[model samples]
Target: MKKNGFKVFIVALMLLSLCFGTLGAQAAYEKTQPQTITVLGTTDIHGNVWGFSYENDKETTNTGMARIATYVEQVRAEQPNVILVDNGDTIQGNIMTDDLYNKREGAHPVMTAMNMLGYDSMTLGNHEFNFGENLITRLQALANFPILSANMSRHDGTMAALPYTIVERAGVKVGIIGLTNPNAPRWDGEKVDSFIYSPVGPACKKVVDIIKNKVDLIVVVAHVGMYPEYDEEFGSDGANKILELCPEIDALLVGHAHSTVSEIIGNTLVGGARNLGREVVRFDITLNTDRQVTSHAVSVIDMAGFEPSQALRSEPFIAKTHQETRDFISGGVTSADGTTSGGIFGKASVDFQPKNEIMGMPEGKLRDTAVMDLINAVQLANSGADVSAAALFSDSSDIPAGDINYGTIFGIYKYDNTLYRVPVTGAELKAYMEWSASCYNQAMPGDLTVSFNPEKPGYLYDMFSGVDYEIDLSKPVGQRIVNLMYKGKPLSDSQKLTLAVNNYRYSSALKAQKLVAATKEWESPNSIRDMLVQYIQENGTIYPKVDNNWKIIGVDFTSPYREQVVKLVNEGKLEVPYAKSLNVNQLKKDGILK
Candidate 1:
């Protein structure tokens, strides 16, 4: 009886001690103010079922989905207030996501994995349209988190189930709204449609009016272009324009461009996780109930940095489900090892960066092959094609300024961009060329701008594949091209020839050639990258500015009215000479060369 009484006393003491410890920790936490709101985010995921492939970089690692779930679990344990968000491109980044949902109609592995992880919110990217509206609606139904978009609406003007959500934490409500890339259906092709993306300004204003005073903070989850090139409607880059236009927004979770921008703009904090499930963005946002900016802290929790999350591992049949879906698409166009001299090379010197980072004008070698060889091969390969051209810039902002890797390849050649053939008159071709050059023009308050940023939403700044041309930004969109030269001679309108471009250019929203509003067109079996990569692989090494595929022959303006084209020279803009050729190393150092 005495021993039993002693044991009970000991248990009581331990329980009391535990309670005291909890109270002490709570008291300490209450005394100090929260530092910042860390917004954990990922973008352009395009369904990275494989998770991050490597340790240091965002390559594929075996940790796979299991690791991601485990990581999220640990993070949640550390800070229960952490809001997990996805910035779009989730539907299409990986073949597993695309191949499964696109090819079959049964289970969605990405959605399943996300639900298991308890993602807070997500936005839509252009690639999401690839599955068409039916699949998206179904996916939305499957997604537990609020799908947000202050901008996107159905064709009939009804909002999707996914609307912006104001997640409340510590008396502060953070309003998160999603906006699809306006050019998604227009630039992507027939695979996507049935939804219209509204401009960021109006869309943001519309949402702001409703949530402004009601919420303490506003966050825009955008998959639109990040940098400022042309203005479709969102103004500059989505974040820049969002901040410029919507001061109410406290932070922006950015994606689409895929460039690394880690800093605060105005009062808002901006952050993004690298492509694939490689990195995780950790954000802890603190706010007052009054809805004005108070304080927030943010970090990109490199997914590779954490051990693969346990949630991903013990997710009760998730691995088996994923394996089933993965094995289903094994026979499709998606396959491992695109092939190379050493490892898997998506393409040769012609690394196709979906964004401007890799195969960019700054990364001169790939840029040279991107335009020159792409155009040259298309022109030469097609006897009837008049001129072949390729566009470099994109509306999406965060193309990584680093070595070309799987993600680089993924970003550069994002779409199932097939070669499109069209017969356009020389006059029509020149008009097209002008459209490309006009991408460089900066619109003043008076001069009208395209409803969208050309390079970003889609490739509006086209460099002729087979012809050399100059831009007279002085002219309108139809008249921008001048001194149209083919092989050093002035171009003739009557020349009967076929022009080639990605299938995306054929869409009615964007004009490329025969594919535009034309019922009849030839779709190449080879991907656009396949041709370019094959050319480089066969040609060995590549040099920039070869054969002078094109030269800036016109408009030299400055600042506001003139083009924002920053010469790479020792100028204050970019450190390098603007036109000098570069390699992967130099390109990485320059970061995202303007």
Candidate 2:
């Protein structure tokens, strides 16, 4: 009886103590003055550390981690309570970065720079898994900050990453929950096969449920950007959807679209930065004495003209590696002066100059272009596929006539997509062409230029080689391809042919998104970039000329905007054959047409 009475007393005493402790902590927190915190973030940095463009082998004014470092220092100096964060896609864009990445060595320059920047936390972008799960794990281990991704899980249902992390500052707890794009598995293919992605809305809700009561403030660092509506068919994981789904989230940082966004989405504060470390999105948050978020302001700090820190540049290890990369890119492989044989020594007796040709001409009227020809030639020689499909990655991509180096290689091919050979029926090939043709808007009388479908990205429009075809823009979307020919013979719908394409285009998950159909025949571990490099190394010189295989069938040449359109094309204002019509309107508004 005595023992039972003693046990009851102890339990009651413990409960009383816990209650008082909570009340005391709350009272003390309420008594303190409200603290203000500044949150600075960067997204989709894409391996830009030196403010350098490897394609052009020159420094650009817009990007670099060094500039971001200076900005971060400036922000920290002003606000002692500042916390730095990164939204993902940090690695794997530049040539130097790719060189190190392909090595799979522990020495990652991008991660090294991020650590130096002192990031608090980061989320995963789809591109982070491009090198595969193992490499991503290695990269994640290198980060001093917690890399968060709540939606991703192993096939066995174990969390691939932490859902949220709470950091305490000035007696207040701030919870940061991360959500990656749910469409990752579709785009990254086998690279993310072992993982499952949860719907972002549910994932955000799950994290919020776990962290809401524990923290004074909640910040969502999601790789998904803001979009008007949820695209279930395309698997879009937009910020607006999360804000709609989770009311407990206080602030949101978003990326993956590479769009500069800073605006209030309902009651939540949201923002994103441009690609390649060009700028940083800043959020200044104010809290009440009770530790509730009161007001938040957001802005973008452009990195242009921001000087890089000499200390960072002078870091011995990074400096040495960077210099080696520069040298490798600048060095000539094969020249007329009888340089050491890298491949086919001096195959072209004369220097190969890439002619700047207008892209996106309507079918039947399409002219052969040096750009498409060069890419097609490389694909044909490497894949040996009967037909090759290639896209114009960039309108400005060009290789000078005098010399070609690693820089030129990246210039021509911006992505590190692996080569794929897929068996496709002639009907499917035509359907693919039709899908590619959808990239361009129909030519209208008032339309000053051949504009692109604003809904589609430029990289989706593919130009083909090893086959001759005509595209009629006047026809309906699915009926664009006509007069298609293979080896000077009319292509029949039932005929089967091997087509060379990139892994991104051939991805089963991506094919559904793109509405392309094909049967995979073979895939190579070899990257198209490496293939191009090897081809150049073998053939000492490249002679790029178009076969005039594809043409645009119908364009209203008599349109009132003809002269102005021609002028724009000549001046290179029409960089993308299919640009948004807004671009045309802008030119007219600028009086460039008059």
Candidate 3:
């Protein structure tokens, strides 16, 4: 009986030993099985491949993909398992890329550079649709990596590109899904054609479910950026929504707002690099044997002073193409004898040129500037519409005094918008003007400076040529435009008129409250930039004039105050806390209300 009891005790002890031995082995194996994968991300590159600004016609300190290449190579040397991804907007921003497409007709320079850099995947940005599907197809063929967008579907419900990609690195299976902004249909106008853009949230959820079990780590390379407020209904904030819905996603790299961000929400790490290759986001991820992400680190490397990578500069085809593009852009339109070629601008004189004209008057109000005048004149001349609606695309979009080149043309007109002549009733025109005028913040007494509505973009604040109107700052938006006049007569709501507007603004105006429902009288196949180029070459000189047709009536501002406000605002030093408030007195105290 004692011997049987001893045997039972010994067997029980042996079982206990085996249980602990298994646990110890598992822990030891987990410790030995850690695999690290490095991810490099860039977004909104915008065709700044040479690290130079086409608008300024000079090298920029904080931009370009060439500089990013050097930083990428350094990381590659340190880490053997590195994955590179782009968040789209890789084309259609700089004239260099545009020239390459229009002139060379070969592989796009951006594609060549990205391929040489060994990009694993890229999402489609809204701007990618600007040139239409042909160029997009050509690029896809040239690219060695997958250009993806899960939310982008064809009319027949086919995926436009690969929805997601699973890449293996150092034994880590990483799943990446790409999402684009859903507003592409509206913003890109007819450029998107039959492609349907789904809301980012739903697309991401669908992709995540399919890949969650197949891959150990999930990363979303979204072309959509963080918004001031996340609207679940619109799914505007794609990155955050994915993080919230798909807990399996370990990282979210974003772009499109041109803003930088880094934060951890729940169990995911989110980061966005600024536009123009000014910065890049890198993720150092550690995974265990189970392929579960054990830990990760995020870093944003600024490319301001980094040396250009030899990989980019040493590539003979890329370097030669870049030089050719530089030379082409440097060519400009000038008179044979260096004298102004007479045209409508000849009457306004050289002052009408876009050189130094200020678009906004002092006291933070809209004023007629030659920049808009020239653009409006160009549109009207080309379309022959009764009225022309135009806006300042960029605050620094200035044409230097002497010569106008392709570079200058792009600086003034940023997008590849085409001119359209549309018919509109007087009421609709007034409504359009009102909607534009509402871009200004309500003025308060003692406020010496005028400012735009903080919630609105500068491009949305449009001015009209061939019509006269007054915007009363005291009145609320939608009721601000009063005393509308066209051709020396009181413009009646029922009056039908032909208006010239860009394709982009036409779409935007259609959505404006009570805006004109104009029908298209004519749509030019030639882009507005092409028209401007032709106009400049044919005229050989441009002089623009502002007739002071549109003014801010409620503000008591003059030339001196206008000068001060313009300087401050253009310098990005304009501080108007009451910009969105109706506090005129506070604006006065702040020396902005004049």
Candidate 4:
């Protein structure tokens, strides 16, 4: 009886040991299961904190920091491991940031909102330097998160900001390298003179080599687009160059071109969101127990679908600043001393631009208008240049017949660009005009209305004042500019002329494109926007007058089908032609406009 009892005890002990071993194996398997990590990114927020357009004096549903905040909160709640980042161009754009917050001393509204949103890190965009180095430093000090620029360095060779930051989530370390656009010096002019910029590709390679082994995943947040904005020989301003140099990058998020980008390049996941918080890029990365990225997916979420977060909008500083901005735009601001400023600064006699014949087409670009003329006149008057060039920045830009306020001025000229007077030979001027004329799509036979080139952004199509010229659509792009005259005489190729252009145009287009060999002779002390306000304030009332110095010729829109297409577009039955030119023939070919 004793032997049988002992045998039973041994059997029970063996079974218990087996059961414990099985449990341990199950725990090991669970630990090795793939874990998902999510990375959220916002780019080119451009000071839309309240998701409102101070220029239009209305609430914008499609964009703003508040909407981004709401979407981010939703993402954080759904995911166990999430990281938030901003790609840059956050500081200066509209009236609020450019006029109000950017000038003030304490916390910047954009930085304040970003801090509240819990941005992990931010890459420095070119526009961030618009207010100069001092403002950038103040903003950096105000930000709770790291402001990173690996490619930018001070004279002492130290990095301008943190090169990269590592964040750990779910035991997975992510190394995010921030690369600013090298062409910042070009666009920002002297604002970026204190710092030195190196090519993005080499700078990224160097950083990756140092941090690749230390982190489980390597991601790059670049303030550059996928393709080069200009010639690559000048400097690398695209993320594609970075990937070529650092193929080990697990993912890359880019901005600055303000276009939606989502694609997979080899093993790396690449994504970019649109400007002004219009979209958010989400990257989901799955990793194994060994911390190797197993799989990943990238998507761009539109902000229109998300509601603005009341919590973010109601944040003390944001709420107060938003109302103050609106007040400053409409009425004026009363200081602590009881002195009010910034309300009706000037007046306009009539609307600057005429109504467009075709929906979504900019008539101002097709011919000279008071809006462009006034901007050019301001540049010419301020700088004493013989000639001036400016662009109709937005299709909707116009000075309405009413009291002129800061918002009204902003509508006329959106960018905070300083005037630059440069000396250009008549040949160089012609070359520049030819380049600008290329913004129009080549008109073919049977085409009803003139259309702009989809690839050429409206900002690039500059119209010249102080010169008489015509863009002949019958001619090719290089030979489009004809009847070029200055001071009632044909402009000779050897004739020297002083050209007034914005600092941005001088650097990005004139110098970068090698279109002109001239150097800037003068720069305005104030922004062109400020000059416009001063001009209006001094004149009391401005009139809309077109000199008829320039016009588009050689294109015939006499087709009866043109009216039908325009009607359809205006009625919303047919979509506005943007991605490609939609003429009457094409519409009929598709059987859309019968």
lDDT of each: 0.57, 0.75, 0.76, 0.86
Q: Candidate 4, residues 1-594: lDDT per residue as tens digits? A: 899999999999999999989878866675577778899988998888889988767899899999999999998999978999999899888877877777778877788889999989999988888888988799789989899999999999887899999997766788999988888877776778899988888899999999999998888999988877764664487788888889999999989989899999999999999899999999999998877778899999999998899999999988988888888777667532343335887888989899987778778877888999888888889999888999988888999898888888888788878889999999999999999999988777766667788768899989999999988887888999999999999999999999999989998789878899978988888789878888888899999878989988876667777777778778888776653455666776888867
Q: What is the lDDT of candidate 4?
A: 0.86
Q: Each prediction's TM-score against the native?
A: 0.63, 0.85, 0.84, 0.89
**What TM-score, to 2 decimals, does candidate 1 have?**
0.63
lDDT of 3 by residue, 358-476 (tens): 33432212567777777888899999999998877776666657656677777778787888998888988888888788778777654455567866777787788888888888788
Instruction: Give the Cα error of residue 374 in candidate 1, in Å.
Output: 8.9
lDDT value, residue 563 of candidate 1: 30
Off by over 4 Å in 1: 1-38, 52-71, 170-172, 189-193, 225-229, 232-237, 287-294, 310-414, 430-490, 508-594
* Runs in model 3 lying further than 4 Å from the true structure: 1-32, 102-105, 228-232, 332-365, 511-514, 556-594
Residue 9, candidate 3: Cα error in Å is 60
Ranking by TM-score: 4, 2, 3, 1
Model 2 stretches astray by more than 4 angstroms: 1-31, 228-236, 331-367, 508-510, 513-518, 558-561, 568-594
Quote the positional error of residue 51 for candidate 2 in Å: 1.5
lDDT of 1 at 250: 69
Better of 1 and 4 by TM-score: 4
Better of 3 and 4 by TM-score: 4
